[model samples]
Target: MSVDEFCRFCHKNLKIKGVFSQSTKIFEKTSNAKTVFDRLIDLGLTLKRSPEKSIRTCRRCTSILSRIERDLPVFRKWEEEEKQSDSSEQASAPKAADQSNWDPPASKMPRRVLHKFWPNPPAPNQTRISMSARRSITEVMTHYPSSKTVCNVCHPDDAGIVNNISKKNWKTAAGLMMRHKDLVEEIKVKILELVQHECKTLCNPSQGFILWRSSPEDLKSFSFSSLESDLNRLSPFLLSIFSTATNHSLPSTCAAAAIAVRGREPRMSAFSYYLNSILLHGGARKAVFKKLSKMAITTTHCHAVGKLKEFPHTCGEGLQLLEVQKEVLPTSGADGLTDSAGQDDEGIDLGGAIGTHRQRDSQLKHDLVDSSGSQAGQMCQEKRQKRRQEQSTQEEEGAEWVSRKRLRSEVQPSPLRLVVDCSFDSLMMFKDVRKLHKQIQRCYAENRRTLHPVQFYLTSLGGQLKQNMDETDKGWVNWKDITIKTEHYHEVIPREELVYLTSDSPNVLTELDDTKAYVIGGLVDHNHHKGISFERAKELGIQHAQLPLESFVKMNSRKVLAVNHVFEIILAYMEMGDWQEAFFTVLSQRNGAVPVDQNGQAVEDKEDDDSDRESDGTNTVKDNTSSMPDQQEGANEQIEAK
Candidate 1:
């Protein structure tokens, strides 16, 4: 039976109807209207009193409520046949007594046809991953299917169904790598042969060199299967293009490193394993991070690109774009976007200036002490001179005042010093080291794009790479814009002066004043090293500031985020001046965790998997290398030599 729905606010009976079912499954005749989050202000009962749980609409609140997806009603559409049969049964039935005998015939039908279409049975219930784990994966990447086993393309559990990777696709990627590698070597060798002075001339921030590598002919000629099959031999070339401009010449400026390649590989590879050894030896060299996805990142806003059918440049969000071939066209900076925002201020200032000039003219006519002669008197001339001098002086002072204010506001009293506390407890293990490397690489990338790149200090000096490191093997590659001191961060920055920005602290980072320099721990201890950062901070007596996460938005996942993700969030917040805006810009609706209000108690990480699929992009290390078999032989040997 249809029941009238009423808004608690207007108390008006809506067109919406609620067929009361013992089950939560929604019946027909409910209206879906736009819902708003009134931010828990005294905006009445339309929104709730608590900010987090306040997503209510006293009106027709259908699927309008967001963030909390489980709150949405499960609608079951009533079929036309069901309606007809019910009507016929009512007409044919004798009375209310016979109505018990008459069951709705259509109710026997299943809501969704199952088993008829060939497929496996419904999956059994799964143990939910912890919120911290969800967040770690979310931080470094866009959504990939739950790849529990090996890649479907590489070793398909089932034939005829590809899980986003194919053999031929690997061939294309490998082909591109080979061609790029060949071209780079050729260019560099040719330069060495021809020029004597500086081969560094090819180096640029925005290098516009596109190679038609991976063309139809090249793909056909190359043994892609062999390359894909034997990744160890092929990976070094990919690494060259991906991470460094060393062995291969990667253009300094590229929009994306788009890999419209087919094929899937495991998350852990020979690349990461070998990388771990290198770090253990020389200490983590140019830190590293990956992935295949459609990426549309403008300098301002990063979002999903529309369908490829509608727009051609929009390679699927899953496809990673190349660095040189950037995803976005250059647009005016934030200043241009808000040029009109300051219009009112300009208008007021202009009006004030005009009024002041009028007042000065009036004073000249009235405030003159003496004017005796018909032909312009000496007093009049003196008054005019005085007025002109005053006007000039006033204008000069106003200009100086504005310049001074702008300098104070824009110029830094002290530039924000960001630290990478690489000095973690020594026996931390392998996987965490890899994750830490990925974090470092990501921070470097984020800093490159920051409006004012932060001064990065990579502290905790001693390790393997430092032992026999040559003069040429040092400094961050192609990142002159950023001040990153590996081990040297302490030379300039005192350890005591550093304030840790970690989740361990209770102090929410509401504002960043010109005073304290912030530091992010370089260790990825998983949850195994929980509160290590906080403990370290406490022991050192360095003040700590946690990100204002719960204060700003509701999250389901754990508060801990990847190093680069945190840095980018801070940079985004600094640029936009809003925590919410910065959070949304970097974190997607699905992958990002939002916490709800819970009586000041410790917020539980619920078994919610709904938002796990949403992602901004792949957060994998851009080391330009993928993984290999975990126990690839000679891994130790290779690290020892390199």
Candidate 2:
């Protein structure tokens, strides 16, 4: 049992020279494998240990030492079992394998019992590391989960749970915020505080210095409950950062701001939400528009001034040249005064300068060459006029070109524009869902206790849809709406599993139809209905004109797909609706029928509870549609200052 044989045979000829050197502390100072193994043996252990003689003969001492240290628990267990089995023989057994059988009898009962209680170990040749230890390493390295129950030690709270869910378990992470309200609020507060402090510090000499100084790792390590919570707080700061940078281009500045603010939050959605928030706030929106207007004016002036500089130098030099032409015209005297004047039709008139008769007649006889020069001068004037006309046309064209390709203008549409990528049918459904979410949030904010189950579903679905739309580059995809004429107790299914459902009829409206209704908005905020499937989910879907499944497996999958899509659309619609309200208030001085508060500004509020809308409204039950005739009058006139 010498260390040399174990190192040479078992260690695959591995070397341990630097940190594992013979004189290094692992081998010399801290006690070697032989010490640990011998200690266990001295405690009446059955496991064999390399004595000092055996240790001294070892070739690769560090490897043998490490192996023995790692296996100490196993050896300790075997020793205990042996002692408990036969108290007398445990003292006499010198060879390590003598007391404990390394290859115990393979009985069916024992194997069955082991199988029932424990997972099978990794094959001997396949793994040198313990499976549990490997899993720990994996959890440490990854930002996501890998199994049903992640190591709770690695994830103490919902933040850890969310971090692992995307990679290891999407189901757990997707709805994490709904489940962990307290944690979500705590995270939201921290982020808001950070953002507010960062924004206010812009007045300092070292403005934006904190963002530049803080490492991304440190920022991400800050607790985050959900992506949306992070966006609500962090977005304003990110947009402000770009807006404040004087010389930075908008696109580059926005990108840098996005990176700087990206931590535990999903960076892409955060970017979109942040930009949207800027558009929502009146001051930020005004600042952006002002900059754009100034830019356009400055560019136009520069170009126009440049073209003006190209105008010909004409006043003094032209008069002198014309004087010479007048003298020459009379010298070619074969024609009368009238004929010569007609022949010199293109010549400039010297009549206005001929105040005195002497000066006029002094246009004395001149040579043929001067007469020809006068004609040539006339040609030059004609050419210059034509060039000016062409230049004017080109200038107009150039202005048009610049207008089309301006820097900020290119990126402007990306932020301010709302694109609906889903099918007509789905979009209509989304609209209903969005309205529901808004109503729910208004209720929640107002401290209303109860919400109809249908209303809750609609609100919660809206939030989910919004999240999905924000997650993708293209935003949302259109699907035909499920329209049913008759109601039935149809089985409900998830949206995804219904991918193969019947296509729209030839008469059905496609997404391309201009008149198609869009899923304008929604919110997935109902917290109490977690995990409860809606009644007749599958049957309801089918009755609502969803296609039948091929088998039970397909039916369940289709149900799930349908549900997921519905939820995703719900999320997208709700947030978009929130932004829509915010944007309307900023741009139009009216957000549907939402009333202004005492501060003379539209209440820039979130619809957290259903009652919030009614309480906040100066005229309770004010219309919430932008389409009503005289909508502006309703918002401005309906609410008197109180």
Candidate 3:
């Protein structure tokens, strides 16, 4: 009997307890019982007592009925007014008009108004059709047959569902099922596999992976205005596989599948669309460029944003002047006259005068030899001696000026010296080395931008680090105010003047010591070689110190910053004279750096509590370090591990 019973309201099986079948008992116990009873009456249930069968309702329906009972009265009044108006309108219609010619007035009730009365109304066929039309392109595409043949690796069930989808009026089928999330994921997997397979067939890894290249004639064909356009322009092989897996000929579906594959294996596709887009539309933010690089949408931030080609001409000119001084001063040594003559000849050649200077010198020497006995020859000899004396005096004066300039630069040096100790070259991978080179370039750019830039020394610059810089960034060597040396920092600068900056050091730098050269280890080990810099500093017996990061700010990540970031922070402090401002300015919010007071409380939190503390007449501060001893210890241990 219980198995046969069902809820009269929801039509669900009444297998559980708490069934409310008796109207008399329900009205007595439940609030808003009259509305519930009236609803049951509207459902055609009689109030007469019947022992054989009664209106059974499940617990879920009972709860819902009770909850909606309060709104039922308003709905009923509105419904009654609508019914009376409809009846009056029907009666007013012309009796002579044919019944077929008169169409019933459209329902005036809003969808929400109907929902209050019938919460779970059954969906009509037309509503279902409209909803299917409104579904996403991917969902709509699952019902269409693929233009290309399905891959052998495709699941049989997926293939069958795709095949069964009719080309015309698929909505007419009563038993057809749509693919769900699992099916979509399977399609994505199949697409990736096919892409890899195709790549294996067409690509050679040793030769490098370039999916497609646009020729001069085909440049117009490669438009990156939208994903659809990009998809339409994808390589024929990729397009075919993506369309087959997604079971649609639409460019959007193929593009989505290709994007999914690219996310998994970035190097599989050339991403010509994204690359071209970045190139054509430049000046994107650094974070945007970085995000694109991380997504593998672009190769590198510098390349994507065109920063690699921006050379500081002022710095280059200064370096060129210094180089000329060094070259000229060295040539003015013991064989000064001969070297001066050679240089004069070279200068004449460079000036497009070619053999004129050499011919004049030869003619003068021949005249001096031939007219040795004549008064004119004696006069010529005296004139030549006088000219030689004048030339020697001029050369001496020029050498003295160069020496004085060199002495002034050496005596003053820069107030602050920034040394990048690039000794850990063997520890870095190829990609890390590339990243280090980019950071070094940025450091140079930052230094050159300032009015009083510090002297930058890149020491121990050999091995792969040197090779990458030489190949990619040739301007580094000629950059002004920078010294690139292949020897160790100790060999270049005195050990007494060297003060290494490492994250693991116990000593915190309170101020910038201009007298001592601050050394930053030029190693990008990706946290693989933790404390290596500090250890090297200790072994070399150089004073090591770390930036006062713990006192000024709190980082969401480890305090270990990139080389350029550290350099920029130092430069910022030198200009602003405030460590906190420098940290905030140099460290991006993306790094999760939050400003904190000297007490280690966040600035925002401190500001909010300042008024409360002032009103209370108490300046007592809570010592969080004392409260969370265990946490602090754990953090210290973690830092040590890192």
Candidate 4:
């Protein structure tokens, strides 16, 4: 087909002599085959006759002839020698019986001469050799559907040659090597089927959008401005997709459908429409409406209405629509553009109408209605401007009103009181507790004098006294005025009862019971304090005067009395100037209270305490002894000597 073939008649017994003879022969033949051979000559497959004329031959076929040609390069000499031999033989030849019927004998010619002039036509199978040659080339190349093949027109490394081998061909080449030609074609068919199915399925408008959208090349070609216009115009597409879809896929479908239907209509501002719709239908569609309203409020609340004055045109339009119309426009005349004659088929003469209004005798009328249209339109334009000015004035007036209202609703007298009975050792740890007490006292004094919002009465346990806390003092807080009278035992009495009180006057007492209090042990050492039990207090024991620390409660769970004993040892060690040993002993809760005489003097009992006391060369202090103290001292000395 590509002109490597030839006609049977063209190659038959014809001795080619000159360029003219070949041309005349080719011109005589009328077969399609001859036409193909000429085309083959043009394509350089067949050889030319001489310098003056061109002929081309298939290089592969010519290569075969070249092998024979190499055996004899003296073709012109050989032809001339043969012609001379023929002329000499013919000139001396006797006339044959029938010259026309006589055929030449092969024996009469030399072997080279026989090989040269004798045409050995190929066998029947080899007759279609050109087709076979093409098939052989295709076979070697693994028969991929090449965009071009190696022919007379192009070479293997042709100008358009690319290294890109098809993925399909890669597999087919492997298949051909494995000798599985059928399997290769089957695989190719399946792959093609899948590709076609995918293309067809995704070819619709919505799916097509996704296909294009995802492709970088396609997206580069798509127009974003056009897409926005589409979204505006195809709002119904979005609505349809949104309404039909009720699951996770809705968003994608809506986007695709909207894109597919895009650019079909003029644009509407989405944010404005969304906000207005919410405000209008919020009562009916409560959830959706509320969401929109909340977003609107959030947006508007941060926007300074006063700043709207800077953009007079935008603000004015909003105000006119909202305030002037109260969001309800008259059906017919609201636009204010309808001529008095009304309903002109050719539309209103806007230019003429504006001209006529300009000729009016009043400047105020001109202000109300501009060259634009309608008083309504003009009012809308000025609404935002008016709102901003009004807002500024309103803010100033509101500030004065707020101040007067505050003066009238001054703080009322507080009748409730709080009190705390802190253990002395536990209360002394925090430096700020004293300051807090002074503040409470000052606040109480002020309340008594002026009768402010709050009143207080204060009391604390003065000394160590172990009294059972009554149920009233167990996690109970009083707020009533009648109970205030009954609980009043003293103006300020230390009854070993944890109490917080507020006084309206120096005379009126409010005893606060069961209030939470926090105790901070001494900063230097913390192992000593007998405050009320935090856990037991929670279960209605004595209400704790101090909030027990989590670390303390977790680290030490002994009885409050035992903790107090440890505290006593720490205090006595500090007094005795044995703070270093005390520090270690307190850290691990291994400290024990020092033995004391009846007069409450710490006495060294055994070897350990004595060793600590004598470690530092400071003499222990001695106190005057009474008769009872002398007896207690004698007994303490014997115990220490033990």
Candidate 5:
């Protein structure tokens, strides 16, 4: 128990002297009333050799205890007066038998004597006291769990004190109010939980990372060097929490949990920011960040390899509020980290509360073989290097051979044109429809504006199209061989009328077959319309296939993607003939499906592609890049007139 809470109940004693003597006397004489010490012992608290310094007094005892030594201004004067009074009045005089048995009255002194020996020196009559908490912030936190209560006790000032705290001289009259409390490590943990919670909200949720206390001597332990090496390659949210002052802050004082957030640049080189907050130091907490270099820690996507690269600066307060909210109303990790305002507005891809352990394993693995042939391998490598050096030294070399391999590598064409279903134009909002028009126009221009390998056709377009999206003519459509029509998809094609693709579809398109036309819904639903194409495809009795988003990646947000994004994935897949490669190429770095660490090694997930097998017997396991080019030759095919 804190010093003020002597018995867990404040005795509110106006005056106190000889704290230990009075406590011992009360405990020794009490018969019916349980003493604070007795109560503490009965609670099975004395099992340890050392006392629980955090809790000292019991719930029922009256307090003769006072504030912390530093809190009392006239403590030296009070102790001196009591000592002088005891020496001059009582030491020389002998007590009578009746008086010896009688105990001195508690706090029964004249107003003048008490005023001179007041427990708390009277101040200019102020209604509310404005100072650091009477007890340490941690001590007060233990008593009151609410952030508001903790803030009130620790900061006292609501306006500016909580945010802008400067160090004061230790020897000054008011003493030091700021204490060293390191929240870096704790805040890092909370950020991960928040991001994990919101992973379901991002178009692509990335393999996230948390790095702490990195020393140059031990960079490998937390992958700090790896982070820097891949810093430029990273498309991620970088949030660093740092104190404006030099590394160490005041210790054992009221420290803030959530602080201000500013732009992030000096670290990850991303358009991110750092959050600054006060940390409260308790018993053993160093309060200062252990390493000066790591005084401010960061959390973000691991070794960015994909396109999704920005974290909105507006989401700062929302992320910090998450840490505060979960502590107040504790719940399961699945429960979103949010205030009463809701997680949608915050844009933090965080769902679920903190402290859930998501396993971390290397997605990339290589087997090591130790054998007697090591010496042979080393000699062979030396020989190769020597041969290369000797060749460079030579004046003349053999004539270079020119192979006709490029001429022989022919791309076989297939009549499998991909049709764009423009039927759901009205189902989406105006903004979404507009984005769809712009994206479609750009998608063709970037990939295949002239003699494109993949044939593009726009079908099921209604006549009442918007001005720019009109059926008559637009930039790419007017300039290129792009086909645009107002016929329903079923009326345009017969055999494989419509092979609709969507995110929520159950079937995974395993192979691309010739003579079958694949249809993509040309719609971008930013925040409106879901499952529209899927439901329409089902109603039309057409084959429905969702791009294997679930099979290839795990997204923080819904797997639903933009029209252009899906179209690009299809083109890359047709060229690469590998779902994993295409998914990685087209999806944002945030997609959780498979995460590559800083070394570009795949993080191993036991339940990933290896565990899953397609009916066609295609091994989903990733292989070396050298083998992919060979497969690309057979996979490359163009759609033509049947």
Candidate 6:
């Protein structure tokens, strides 16, 4: 009998079915597996197998081991190269001199070092300087050259100052200092001020260079009243860079300064990258355009910027233009027709007054004018027909326009209630909150466009998420078939009717029930808070379920869908009455979702592997054992007995 054990590498506990036995034959089939086995042996991991106790590994640990095995050789080579370079540098470097035996030259020595070597002799009637003042003076002198010439700040007279204060020059030093007593005192104060400034600069370097090395606080303190003058001082090229980086909305000098300092580097913000995308889409040359793109900034890869323009904002403007065109075109056509009729009447009057040959020529000219008019009319009719054909084609392709009044009156809302629990606001960061708000807006927009919009409920809506929604989507309060509340879902609806939809749920939902209120967690944590929604549902004692994603389709990545994506999928299914079609229509190609057969295999892969099924006898035998009814019944009997 085989017993379940923890994985040898990751130490993850695996059940009997999940355990993968470690065998030399299996290792030989994978690339670099032998090397990984040897490395594990070197690290004191036991791989010896026995009849009673066999070595086992989990699937995740096996995959990770394979990846490490493939990359280990490159890492080893890099380490060896680094060691060789370090050894070479050490071999060619000069040795340091013995500090006890060597000394710097007297002329180039620091004043602080000179003071350490020699001491001023004590004398009667000599005023003693403070230790702090002496230290300040020593600091100032360290930067200047050691010379006998008098410093103008210290000594204004043409007398030489004492550089070497020996016994012979002790009287000379005292006399020189006494002669410029007031000047020396004044210079000492100035030296202290200089040292203080240097210390301040060392403490906070941003203050010393306000323009180039400014901190966020310093930038924020800039006066907006002088913004115009400050902007004038900046070159047009720099201003243009800032303008493009901020999407042409330079709010204040602080924002401008932030861009000047931080925007030079790549991957500064999402707004910058969005601007870069806009420039690229607008036909800007890639080589010349250097703002927030990876080619220039090199921090992030390509990302999808969802909904580049707001639908309602742009759609309203387009409808207004259409209305204006409708009003102007008819009036212009009527005026042109009246002008043509008046010209025809004048031509008739001229024909009566002409001679026989002139009248004949005039009649020919009139006939030519009538033919031209008919030709113009035919061209106009053809254009109108073409326009009508385009409109009909658009309608056939499902681009038919729906008026707001008709949409509100005709389409009936779906019976199924969809609740978005926004109580997870505390779990997400500021940026995640904003992203959640955007997704909620997209959900609302999608529901409005769909024929059968669900009864939408936004519960526990407050905090930063509420503020963002209020600022961007003011009309959400007046939306039909929607309910906004500040209470939890449990308080709003009965626990029996609530069904939390989370990816971590064990129960799979094949189809939605009209009696049940489905709850989607209105949180965007980028997968950080895994199993949170499921745990919450369990704590609340409500039923929890996940979409039947794995049963219907094989995904190349994780089966986590966005909030709007889940909402849209529900709406799609409600309209189409098929899960496969709904998933296919809502999920983009990037998701890599492929429909699977009843055997739990990808359709394409299954088709390709049909010919090799007989050759792969071991896999076929294992599948048979798993699918055997007798074995399944025996396993169930053991479970019931336990």
What are the models' TM-scores?
Answer: 0.29, 0.16, 0.34, 0.18, 0.29, 0.36
Return whichever of 4 and 5 wins on lDDT.
5
RMSD to true structure for each model, in Å? 36.2, 32.3, 26.2, 33.2, 27.7, 28.8
- Candidate 1 wrongly placed segments (more than 4 Å): 1-414, 461-478, 484-491, 595-642
Candidate 6, residues 557-623: lDDT per residue as tens digits? 5577778888988998998998888988987544566788888998967865775665666554224
lDDT on C-alpha atoms for all candidate structures: 0.42, 0.33, 0.58, 0.33, 0.43, 0.57
Evaluated at residue 123, the lDDT of candidate 1 is 39
Q: Which 10 consecutive residues of model 2 have the lowest summed lDDT?
A: 549-558
By TM-score rank, best first, the candidates go 6, 3, 5, 1, 4, 2
lDDT for 498 in candidate 1 is: 70
Off by over 4 Å in 5: 1-414, 446-452, 463-466, 470-473, 495-497, 590-642
Candidate 3 residue-wise lDDT, 1-642, digit = tens: 432265443445554366534322323346643644566565433344444323455666666555545566676688789889978987998666557787675444445543443445345543312111211222223222656543343233333344446444466322333344365676678778866765444344443323343221122223323333444444455756566777865645644544555566655444433443334344444476566666655544433222111111212211111113111111111110012223331231111122454554454345334633656667988998987787788788885322212333343334799998888889888878887888888898878766457999898988998899888778666788788899999999999999999899999999887889999888776568888888888999999999999898886557888888889999888878999999999875556677987688988668767756676656666555563455434333321111
For candidate 5, give the lDDT. 0.43
Runs of candidate 3 exceeding 4 Å displacement:
1-413, 607-642
Candidate 5 positional error at 565, Å: 1.8
* Candidate 2: residue 180 Cα off by (Å): 33
Tell me how far the alpha carbon of residue 483 in candidate 1 is from the true structure, in angstroms, after superposition. 3.9
Q: How far is candidate 6 from the true structure (C-alpha RMSD, Å)?
A: 28.8
- The prediction achieving the highest lDDT against the true structure is 3
Off by over 4 Å in 2: 1-202, 205-463, 466-642
**Cα lDDT tens digits for candidate 4, 1-642:** 222132222222122342222222322345544543453344334433433222333333334344544544465467678889988998899757776887765333346433432234356565333211211121123334765554443222221121223334565455343333345577778766754454344344553332224221232233334433444343433434344573524435434443333222112112222233234322222354345334332112111111111222232222221112111110111121111223222321112112232353243234334533766776887997877777778797774222212332463544433332233324343333333333333333333333232323333432221121222133223322212222222334333443211111122211222332212111111223232223323333222332111212122222122222223322333334454343334333322224334443444334446666767668553433354454444333320100
- What TM-score does structure 3 among the candidates reach? 0.34
* Candidate 5, RMSD to the unseen true structure: 27.7
